[model samples]
Target: MSTTWITRAETAADIPTVHTINAAAFETGAEADLVDALRTDPSWIPGLSIVATDRHDRPIGHALLTRCHIGTVPALCLAPVAVLPEYQKTGAGSAAIHTALRSAADLGEHFVVVLGHPAYYPRFGFTRASTHGIGLTIEVPDEALMALTLDPEHPLPAGIVHYAAPFGI
Candidate 1:
């Protein structure tokens, strides 16, 4: 397998493949279902859903960023990042996430929050959200909830994360 991955904004035709990737990556279909629900939700931001493809341009990993809020301030939520089980640990998911975050920055988005593995997300600049006074409505491990600022000029806002309805947070 090539170490390099091609990352790009997900197209309509890539949706089913993305779903399959998510379903296969996780323990259940909930993550895939959440991605499907978020697709039609108002929070869905075009071009923020990204995919990593193999040499033949077949999508093997996916990442999605959706509209959310920190208190009343607008932000983005990174969720359900998935890679094919066979592709796990091959940098496919990381490539898709990096691309999605870059796309968000290019679109002038500032803050992003993710509830994920503390060790995995920090490489993407995510830090313990509670350190910045960021939290969630529901209880989660302080380390599991992380936040990042795409632009250092605009520091991460401190508030409770209000995820999109589909997240059911």
Candidate 2:
């Protein structure tokens, strides 16, 4: 198990490996299929889809950031983060997420929303979205939906999140 995972923006060649990671990480193919659908969705932000690779440069984790809206304000959605089952607790997923968020920040994106584990996401500076008056139209566990402000100057906006079509939200 390599502790040092290399994170980078997804390249054309990494697509298959990414798909496999999603498939292998989740019990169903829904997440992997969503990745495929998101690829062609208008919300797709090319460089925001990131992967974490092993020492041999084989992708073992994936993270995607796509266009979404918080009220009328532009924001990003972090979804379907996956790490190979064998690498579940090895920080591969974390590296991919940190890298994707950093890329989003560098690209001038301000707010990000993620429907994920409350305990896990907080390490990345996420807080319950309700704290910022954010919510989803669809029902989700309150604590599972979290938000982060990439830029402190621009606080998270208040509104229902509009996820991409593929998300069916």
The global C-alpha lDDT for each of the candidates, from Candidate 1 onward, is: 0.95, 0.95
Tens digit of lDDT per residue, candidate 2, span 1-169?
Answer: 8888999999999999889999999999999999999999999998999999998889999999999999889999999899999999999999999999999999999999999988899999999999999999988999999999999999889999999999999
**Which regions of candidate 1 deviate over 4 angstroms?**
none
lDDT of 1 by residue, 1-169 (tens): 9789999999999999999999999999999999999999999999999999999999999999999999999999999899998889999999999999999999999999999999899999999999999999898898999999999999988899999999998
Number of backbone-clashing residue pairs for each candidate, in the order shown: 0, 0
> Candidate 2 clashing pairs?
none
Model 2 misplaced regions, further than 4 Å: none
